[model samples]
Target: MSVLADFERVDSDSGGAVLRFTGNLSLASLGDLPDRLDRVDGQVARIDLSQVARIDTVGAWVIHRFARDREAAVEGLQPASRHLFDQVVAAEHPIELPPKPESPFVHLLAEIGDAVFTAMHTLYGLLGFMGATVIAFWNVATHPRRFRFHATVHRFEVVGVSALGIIGLMSFLIGVVIAQQGAVQLRQFGAEVYTINLVGRITLRELGVLMTAIMVAGRSGSAFAAQIGTMKLTEEIDAMRTIGVSPMEALVVPRTIAVVTMLPLLGFYSALIGIIGGGLLCWVQLGIPPITFVQRIREVVPLDDLWVGLIKAPVFGAIIAIAGCFQGMQVEGDAEQVGRRTTTAVVQAIFLVIVLDAFFAVFFSQIGWI
Candidate 1:
């Protein structure tokens, strides 16, 4: 049976109160003692635990806190109770927490700085990876037999041929939307015929290659990341290195070459499909015959627009491939890392593609291609 803890105050020789505790000083028996101790007052110079029976850590903590708060000495503790009291004293400590920002503005500035730092760090890593890839490409170039033709062809089917259906559907829909909107605006000016020029120029020069890059980044880029990330997690990449196989040449180079080669063909096909969609829309809505629409597109849209898209396509493909493979190479630790890297790869690829497209537009315009 547990005895309920109890204490009483008695005057000592120094005329200071001494709190003499009795009965069991344990977790089960000391329930109301803590609250009662908090209500204590007066000049308590010592705490007498000589009569305390069956003491535990709970009792030790309560007695130690009371003594410390009253600036009183603890006495009459048995050997076991003394050790427990010492332990409780040693364990008392304040927890440290992360410091808060001084103000909201400072917090915002800190976040912006972190973002900039991360961006710069990522850019530096990507540039180094690009350099390594170039060295790998050079090694393969010098030794043509080292090239993996079969792997490259397989990637071509995966990245390009498999992508055609969705790319075609998306491009066709975009073309129809462009033509429908262009016709609506042009009709107000009594120039619905010019909708052909709008659809042709925009799709061929900008939307066709741009949209294709975005889709490939989301589809094939994520796959590249997930595939290589899984390889990394399983130690297959390390095994390849151990066996004297170059991961860059065997894996990265094939993917890079495949995407770079296919993007231009895909872009051209997308542009053609988009133009056909616009022609159908024009025929159905604006009463313009398909033959006349085709003639107008051929007359108004320059061959330079097609060249601009083709030129941008390979660059976009290289960016997407490199970003995906680089993120995949970075994956480590766990399966969750694979998913995170895949998402990062897609986002990074699409962002780079759009940025490069803008620069291409400026360059092409400056060169009098627009």
Candidate 2:
């Protein structure tokens, strides 16, 4: 026999309509309940499923939606069938959700505000580090016994002596290029001999210290950040704190002193190397003797140019050290943070060095040094 289902609306003395279903309320027989429920005339206060022989999930859903739509209750179902009915009812009448609109202008403003807040937080942290470094310097100055002589000396050797060969080679190449270009341009004006003046003035006053500072920022600055960041990751910094040692005193102070003390010397060495390269180029390409090139340098290059470059070296060194150490200290205990902060330290130090150079250029011009 085919599966069958039928229902009847019974009027009750209690004054409510009852929907009484019979036979299988399933896909084979009762699939049209949704249409039948739409034509239902009176309010169905209750459903009587006791007479239904079998049912499926579809049948449960139809019955649940009907009862919910008419504000009626279902009864007489076996416990399992009742559970299925409850599930259907709970699912069909879901909780309403609030709307969320995505406005572009609002999102943009939020991003800008977040960026400003982050920048302010970074600035505040940098100021705190600067203050701590100053205090450490003061303490070391007052009680020289607390200073780490060995550490400072080691850092000086690493940052200054070890870097000389590369710095010299780079400055030499730059000097050769500048001299060759100056000779080319000045030859057009028949003033090729003036290449000496051009090379000497530019190298000593600007490119010498500027280029060395940039190289040191990339090399020593990144090294400082990576070393400190690794120490932080391994909890060496925390261990020092536990043992009543300040990381600023032990780690940062030595590095800072090393760079500040050695950078001027390195800058002077680089300037000398660059001048030698320029002189060599002038001798070979411009047909000027080495002695003639040296005489021209002495005649045209002012002592003020040498002083200006030397004056900037210590400042650049301090900036690079501070930026690197500050970024290193900010690293969270992660290897990835170490790499990220090392790159950040180099980039920030180089950028600041360039900006400071620009300011110095303007200052020197105002003071009639240029």
Candidate 3:
């Protein structure tokens, strides 16, 4: 085949000239085509190959390079030529992206995995902590100023009590929505009374505790990380150590105690709000009185459901605190590190909570507890 046999340029109203082709393809034309195409610099330029009898790799490469480098568009590409263009686009190359661990849907799954791993790690860490606390027990025994009980109490109040209004309001809205959903199903079966059973069991056993833990993960877990992270960045942990104080005993202990103790109470509050909110729904949507709603709850909620919620509390609390502490302690001495740790704390905390919930689901289901 003869190279440059069809190498010819022509001008038109398509706004620019096209270097048209008809016969053979070769590397020599590939080399010169770019410079020739450059001649149409100030005009819209295209290379048309509709009639090219035979095209080789070298010729294709020259045309492709010329078009790309000069931003000259290519025209009349057949399926084969189009596929060649796609090959270059699909080449694996590095690109920048945000550090979000995963996208929205994948993030949900990642959080579940994090919750499970973080729960396991926290349980391991706590075992070690408990051992050390026991060894130091006798030394602090009978000391009047021991425990920093006042500060621990204050943190519980802060993390658990202060969050009630928002949790309560959201729970109420949730209950209303659930009741509305139930009314639709019950209307068909004529079992409207069962809405009470559904909401009661669902809220007390699962939604109550699960939702509360998530809230705490986002709210208190973030605060814990940011606070401790800032302290770490400012050398406060080092300062405590320099003064011969224990970071575990003084810092981690107080926060851990606060979160663990308060979670169960928060869980109870969440359930209460959710149920009462449901009760209000019964009144508004179902036309049942609040008294009847309470009566139904008193009938169905076994002590076991409350216990299920209670049992999960300390576990979730431990997960959130440990995740926060881990990320916080991992922070280096930088302002940006504080924000990074705070985000990690919230995300890891939420993740561990969901995983723990899944474990409870499986364990309770097998035991006929759910």
Which candidate number maximizes TM-score? 1
- TM-score of model number 2: 0.82
What are the per-residue Cα lDDT tens digits for candidate 3 across 1-370? 3656346778878677677876666554444555665565555488787877666666676667666666677777678865765565455367888676657888888889998998788568645655654444433455535567777788888888899898888777877777788878998989999899888888888888888888888888888888888888788899998997766566666777788888888888888888888888889888989888888888987878888999998989887876776677767968999898889788878887898899998999899886
- Most lDDT-accurate candidate: 1
Model 1: weakest 10-residue lDDT segment is 98-107
Indicate whether candidate 1 or candidate 2 has the larger TM-score: 1
- The alpha-carbon deviation from the true structure for residue 326 of candidate 2, after best TM-score superposition, in angstroms, is 0.8
Output the better candidate (1/3) by lDDT. Answer: 1
lDDT score of residue 85 within candidate 3? 52
| Candidate 2 residue lDDT tens string, 243-293 | 988899999999999988888888888888899998899989989998888
Clashes (candidate 3): 2
lDDT of 3 at 166: 82
Better of 1 and 3 by TM-score: 1
* Range of the 10 consecutive residues with the lowest summed lDDT in candidate 3: 135-144
RMSD of 2: 4.0
Candidate order by decreasing TM-score: 1, 2, 3
Task: Please give the lDDT score at residue 295 for candidate 2.
Answer: 87
Candidate achieving higher lDDT, 1 or 2: 1
TM-score of each: 0.83, 0.82, 0.63
- Model 3 spans > 4 angstroms off: 1-146
Candidate order by decreasing lDDT: 1, 2, 3
